[model samples]
Target: MAKKTNKYIKPFKNIFVFILLMFVVWMLFFDANSWLIHHELNSDIEDLEAEKEFYKNEIIKDKKAIKELSTEEGVEKLAREKYYMKQENEEIFIIEYQDSLPKNKEK
Candidate 1:
């Protein structure tokens, strides 16, 4: 009958719509280059930008330190601390007591 055929057509149309909707959802979320992937890439870019800012600040600090090292006292201090350089006939005595100190217990 015509009524029976019309009922079948309606269900088929609904199924087609559902399939199209699912396909769109799959493409938006499950595809290789999807919206979620773009969001992750944006987050990665933000993190890299933050790291770039941190490195820029560090570079500024290093330039300041290099400028200071150009002076005589700063160079001598750096040599004594890092390379353990001593003046002629002067002895260097390093006293390490931090390891011997008692550590505080956490409550």
Candidate 2:
């Protein structure tokens, strides 16, 4: 009687199972739309979504400010503070914070 030997083949799992595992592994790492690619694309999508939300909030704030600026009082307030506009012959005195003042040099 001759003894048969299966050196490389595993008897526990079928060939089909081994091939299926290999295919899955290849797709996960080496394929074009792999797991790593999917993860990076999802991260990009989340960042873009966050940026979109930020810009949407900024747009809403800008629209509200524009509506406020449509009024005379809003324009006067903005001009007075932002541009430091004053009436003719009006003297404006600016008070600076203590921290903002120049430090004294030791003699």
Candidate 3:
């Protein structure tokens, strides 16, 4: 019986086709502008964009807080809530529920 060969095998045997395939592989993986490098750079850009959006939101929130704190009422509210400050001759009470407290895990 004659040995069987596929018709498609001839293309791979051509020197130009092999060189072109190598060049394509080199450009995709080994060149300075490789696909892997581009993918990493694109991911970095996406991360930076997300971080930029986060900082922008934070700046807006900070600006609003600054605007609020510019007033006397805002300062009193922040002091009462955060610092638990009380006016002279006034009392302060704080209530905490069990579920709101941190749970302890014991081994």
All models, RMSD in angstroms: 5.9, 4.3, 2.8
TM accuracy, model 1: 0.61
How would you encode candidate 2's per-residue C-alpha lDDT over 1-107 as one tens digit per residue? 89766765564258787889889999999999999999999999999999999999999999999998999999999988989998898987888999999999977
Best by TM-score: 3
Question: Candidate 3: deviation at residue 96, Å?
Answer: 3.5
TM-score of each candidate structure, all chains considered together: 0.61, 0.77, 0.80
Clashes of 1: 0
At residue 90, give the lDDT of candidate 2: 93
lDDT of 1 by residue, 4-101 (tens): 55764675478788798788899899999889999999999999999999999999999999998999999999999999999999999987798887
Error of 2 at 6 (Å): 12
* Candidate 2 residue pairs in clash (backbone atoms < 3 Å): none
Error of 2 at 50 (Å): 0.7
TM-score, cand. 3: 0.80
Comparing 1 and 3 on lDDT, the stronger one: 3
Ranked by TM-score, top first: 3, 2, 1
- Candidate 1 or 3, higher TM-score? 3
